[model samples]
Target: MLAQLLCKTGLNSLNLNTKLFVSLMLLLAMATQSTAVVAQTDRLTLIYVSEMTEMDSEEKGSYPKLASLLEHYRQINNHLVFISGGGGLAPSAMSSLDMGAHIIDLLNAIEPVAMVAGKREFSFGEDVLSLRTYEAAFPVISSNIFDPITQENLDGVNDSLLMTVDGVTIGLLALLPPIAHQEYNLQRVEIQSPVDALKQRANELRSAGADRVILTYSCCYRDYLNYFDELDQLLHDGLIDLALGKDEHLLLADHQLDQMHPAHIWITQGDEVAVVELTLEKDAPTFLMNWQTDSMNAYPADAQVQMLVDGYIQRLESLLNEVIADVKTEFATFQTDVRTAENPFGNLLADVIKAHADAEIALVNGGYIRGERQYQIGEQLARRDIMRELPFRDQVVLVEVSGEQLLLALENGFSQIEEIKGRFPHVSGMQVEYDRRKPVGKRVVSVRVAEQPLLPQQTYRLATRQFIATGGDGFDMFGDLEPLRYAGQSNRLIADILIDAIQQSQQIAPLNEGRLIDLSSP
Candidate 1:
């Protein structure tokens, strides 16, 4: 009768009174299987997490909050997957070193299955990425990035990862943006297009008897849109199940399956970043969780996780204390965008480039310029903070190029801003415009120097960064320019100029200008 009742209660097959108590517990779990279900011996569960930069104090108090959330999840389930996107590489003593360590420590305690590289993972260069991976104590995978010469993968320890969870075999492939390769001009490493590589690997995984194949990619929306149709077709044909994307700054709401396509798709914005979540079961249902601003209340900080973050903060504070306080100023912070009306920092940088190169016109990449918040007077500025804003130590170069070269650089600088929104060139003495409605190459409609029409054959002494001079961000035409001179550490020059300007006036007030042509309406 007891056996009969137990069986009716869904515990029948287990001999609870016998030595198989553990086995009976597993059986009961399978029956309930609703809230936080541990996978049965035959089932596997993966919790995906991503876009965790800016969770620290530099942005807000998000660092501790994220750690706490991870810890809470770790206490219940030991399987977590992390894919961090780029953009948190701003210079700061706080997260520069300790951010990844703290993130890894908490996740390791939870026992994550694997962590794929997001583009931001490489935002600080290869060395910083290596250090973070070493400290992670988990698998770091970057399959697409390889050594330029050796062609060996630069993923620290492991390249690709396969894990058998809950009776399901899963294969993971990672990819990065091609721009990263172009930025470093990596000789050995080549970043394959995600679409091309995935199809081949998906076949390989399927032939190897894998039940599911997932792609964790860090790329912009344009890349995703370019390949979305093809990927959706793959899912419809049952070739690949899930594709997660990072790199976009905005958060997308969780979306449902495309009615036209058989498969489901979603993109998540992390806490100050974003990630995509995919559940392999029931045909790969996907969802997007915004970790940056939303989704905070649901997952409060776990005490244990907060403790780990505190330790990292302490280490960072110690390092920051040693940085010589350069200048004392009232509360003021500079925005990174430089294409618009010049901020104090931007104007100062322009002055530095002009001084260093003795050129009439100066052009700087909007990539520099940090300090999103206001700095108070008596605040001792540190070199580290400045460096954070200007992470790339690109030198300033003087190029005596024709007006045509200058015009090309301006157009390329403003290339993806309309589509991607933030790639613009800030200048000191020139203005340019292009028709947005018109095709690429023909977009530039007008060009002027200090209100004077530009002369195509006339050579101008222009000061610009080394990266742009060599066609770093699609300014390939500039590489043909006659070399006038090389000014190293243009960032340093700008920083020094800023310090002096602040000291002389003891006041720094900058404003935004609608200088660069905005073809948004057009």
Candidate 2:
């Protein structure tokens, strides 16, 4: 009736003889309301979700209550469940039975609708993946993954989901973290181009009667910002409706869509603010971090969510406790010097390759060891422990290169000695001397294999992870070497050998054999 009255008066003022009537126009109000009711009743409803990782015991910190997400959902009296970033065992748990249970406890309290995959999801392997996927009430979406042999998208997971709220339809699409592909080999399905794939998906949703589409992807902050701008621009132009980014350990920033568009951007974690938009035309999402009277915190954890959390935690504890090792002491620091002319750590690793492959000589770059940390006394270790240090999981291979190719390896390693910070080779079965003052490529004065001068024509066998062998880190010269063998070994990443050696011997010492140090010409 109020809308009718306003509309009648609004129309009356436009006529010349109406005298801009006010109170007398009440009768026409009811008539106007009757017509207005037939106009439009459809609207889009959205509930944004994020993936939150559980904190370890040493790092036990609670996030803002899940009631915040729920309370926001309750306002519309519609269903929109916020979920974790696949709350399973944290990578640090290493199969701890309690890991999943703890996360489940925390998440049940929040009662989210679904979860997206995180890199840590792969920490427990396929069995755990199947277990967690089944246990979740909501769907687990990862579009890019495909089976290695079957070459089909993994079964039991949806590519996306369609939901309706208050007559408003929303489409949710998921993306896997790139690191899951690079570091963990979780690329069971290859990812199609983000922009291309998403555009096609949005069209499909639109054809299926979806009013708006949103993406809930797992990636880093910078990547989120990048795709957000791309999607927001398209959305502002009516290409899509909205894009919600996740995967930062904490909420970082808020980006409002276009000033004139009905789109908004947000990120949230435990204790982070929930962006509130009262109207679509509002200039920005009102940031709300405090538990003021406007927010939700009074509600308790959802019972079903709590049950799932309990089961996951129990399973995790039993599995992780399965002893992988029993060590006497824990090392505080283990220092490794792999750059010197005679690198103890690198030489030991190279010799392993040389012996294992029956190669004449071997060279492995120091960068492969990752940060190459300093180890302390009594540091017990396991297989997963070493794998962490060498996260790339690069395949090990043997290459045969001519003395010129050998010289190239020497030059590359030598160039690193003077030009780069840590590119020097930790070599085995060879000795090298070089001049630091001379320009790179001219720096290596001499190179020898067991006291014999290197012959540019004679081929020498080399063993190294395919990463550097195929020119990772500017070693492109190695991409075209003659193949002697491909050992295909992850049994002992170089870091494992070093850690195990230090753990058992209880002695941590590394010497620089003066591989590339400046020698004042005698």
Candidate 3:
């Protein structure tokens, strides 16, 4: 009967399905024969989803297909459990109407055991997530993040989880990304080094007598192989049975998986999922990874998930559909545009910050303009569109700094050009010329503000987001500014300022205007 359920609902990946079918088929055959039944061990399955951004839903991602798919598996296998890799919680502005609260509801329906906290979760701040975590059916874990304000681990976040399924003591641990501390400064939590935190957490899990351990590694694209030797050692010592991660860049192809014998099973996000079947026998637990990382558009939407999604759409219909601004020319914000060079949206954002703060210059990180979609020339920019584009809910403020500090800030912005990170500055009321070929920390060839060379001794009013004002993304020089305060109060959102500016102007056109030039780039 269990075999019938599995056969009817196929595994997403052929390779995993083969392993699952081969192993389970034998059990099914034995069951049908009514032979002297050998003591059969149960199959424990782990279902996972990760990195769910605003666009990752039936309407934008795979269909309601995921919710019902897991529900079926959960029904058939009492040992089956769902878990998340912790990225689905932020840029709340872009997610379903309640700003990703709908996503929480969706994740809850599947009933995750634990979810790792990722960098995106920090974007929403702890207060908001603290309330929303109550809405979740599962525990949120962040081994590396501790609440600086409360001097404890972040509220509503667990370091790890432990459970027993079919007599197998399973452990789940979550590792927040290591770079969180440098990129985000929360009023609530502080991020410890992930490596140290993970080690401590892993030891605790082993001490707790977990037979199998699963790790939620949100690091994803980093060169973890170099340091994964530790995890490899854990696997060899039998401390860790499996490493569950979601890194699209590091996924192993089906044909190549066996050769690697990887301790980790990395799932690529999107509409895809990983169904891991753990065969529990007297000896060490064995694993079969079913990685289905493609063609989610073809997957049919599950009815239950569809119902939830429909309800959210209905609730947000009025607000989401509202046309906030009508575009005249295209205001595209491709990743390439935001990180490497100036684009329409980036340029407009810089202009808005300068205008709103009534400051001489403004430099906002290109990374702050979030999203993967590009807007068209004539399309109506809805409230949803704006929210998705600027999701962090950051405030705009003014700081007075010397021209010398401004130059250093510009230098810091260009220092990480190779990585194409958020530190890349989009400027207004100023022009920058840099040679990428030059060494890091010395890339700025020339910078001029207000049509004149910056006088080192002179102080000027600067405008930027609170993230930058707080020394996030490595612009620490800005932190030295005096008389720093919100241009209005601390209440003005950068997104609102931009939206209102576009509505007032009735047109959106921002030129590159040679604000930043890289001679090394063609």
Candidate 4:
């Protein structure tokens, strides 16, 4: 047809060389247009959530609702990938009893492609996490964590994973913060630098034929602001295609950092879910990415997941409903009260831990108390109540520290008082007087242990949570000091100790007792 049309249009009148050249150019143009029309585009949607624990609250994001939302996406796009950004494994009433097994069972139903190993995953210790990993249907990954004994990633945990979604090979890596070692029961494992691990694994994945790489990281403790610079550099350098972050419970719009690299997404709260859509064109090495988030409340609960959640809640309620003790006065567990100043409940907790350890003094971080509610006078405190308040199963450990070191620890506690940090000391056998108007390290005006003036040279037996004794919450003054053990020194869970104390006493009346005095108060 082209030859006949060309002859009629007077192409035959041209010389053979010119006619051939024009014909070749037309053929080339036709091939280019055909390739453009035949190009294939694939879409991958990633559904992300983190820091989830309980499924009991309708006000918050529940696993059932999450399941429904996932199904909605799967219906629209078969290339949907669900990612658990870690957390949600422990520190709840049920998790305290079952060591997060219920959460694992619930997640199995959701069937995430990968679950990041956040610090909370080690809340019950490496052994329990190893067991949980065995139960999980999906891959549990942490790129920077390793077991020295195995000389590899922790048992059952992968350093990275590669999956093909709609013909696109996606590489995944999860990173934990450095503080996991200091804050949790991760003594059995070693954490490498997350940034270095990310770079190494990303290159390896690319070399292994991955078309795109995604990272999910929980960096720092509660503050992720400091990690953005390094993440932006990685994005600019083209090592990673997308980055997902956890721990900071704020949506992208609420973040204080206005200018963020386009590839990063921070999904903190369970109530919110983030979706990252990637469009890959056939024969193209790179892809276009888009991100959006929605509330889990927008979706209805999936019937199967709801049934599973209900069964677990019933089992948990049976164990938690028994009345343990009666309170003579209302005890407050408000974050501001417990973290910024002394409260009656904090006093009771410190006293119980001190008595259990048989130590002269006991110090508990305000952050350890998480009930965040006030127990009214005459309210019967149940086993559930205690667990709700102290859910981490933190053990009481005995240590001997000089009065000078004690002073420094107290200073560290008060250092972040302005931020209402968790390090604030809830004391058992000591009275602290401080003027916040003074410099941070020098805030302590005076300290008395057992009603006697503290002697910097004198060493006192201290009873505190293993977390603090091991340098958590900036209590580095106790660095590398081994726990002291003597006759009858039981390193029992702090919650159990408190429960026993309440059960033994039958009735309790605890007061502030002026343990923490702030001269800055008007």
**lDDT tens digits, residues 215-312, model 2?**
65654454444455565566666656554554334323433422423444444443332343222222223211122122223345445554554565
Best by lDDT: 4
In order, candidate lDDTs are 0.53, 0.49, 0.68, 0.77
Runs of candidate 1 exceeding 4 Å displacement: 1-43, 55-63, 75-111, 126-135, 146-148, 155-159, 182-188, 246-267, 272-297, 300-308, 311-345, 370-395, 433-438, 450-453, 479-501, 512-522
Tens-place lDDT per residue, model 3, 182-280, is: 676565577776557767777787777666667777646453443455655665666566777766554444554554335567666466677777765
Question: How does model 3 fare in lDDT?
Answer: 0.68
Ranking by lDDT: 4, 3, 1, 2
Residue-level lDDT of model 1, residues 1-522, one tens digit each, is 001001110111111122223433443454345334443221222334455544354233254565555555434443334443323333333444444455556554443445667655654457666666666544566555656544455536244555544345666666665666554344345677766766766676666656676666654445455555676677677676665554334432235232424323334444432223334353444322222223434456656656766776676565444444544434333433443323445655666676678787887766555555565655666555554555454567788878877887777766665443233567777666665667666767887887899888888888877766766556677766665855443344444444554445554444444345656454
Clashing pairs in 3: 57-61, 64-302, 65-302
> If both were scored by TM-score, which would come out higher, candidate 2 or candidate 4?
4
List ranges where model 2 is wrong by over 4 Å. 1-78, 85-112, 117-137, 143-154, 176-188, 221-228, 247-499, 509-522
Clash totals, every prediction = 33, 40, 3, 1
Over all chains combined, what TM-score does candidate 1 have?
Answer: 0.71
Candidate 4 displacement at residue 226 in angstroms: 3.2
lDDT of 4 by residue, 1-522 (tens): 011011111111121234334544563454345434433336767888888877756544699989988988866665567888888787788887788998888987886777888888988788888888777766678888878888777877778877654456778888888767866636679988878878888888888777788888653325434465786689778899888875443424534446666777765555888888887554555554678887888888889999998888788787688888888986788788888988998999999888887899989899898887887888888888888888886788889999999999999999888767788899989999998889989999999998899999999999899888988878889877889886666656788888888898897678889999999998
Query: Model 2 — TM-score against the truth?
Result: 0.52
* C-alpha RMSD in Å of predicted model 1 compared with the true structure: 9.9
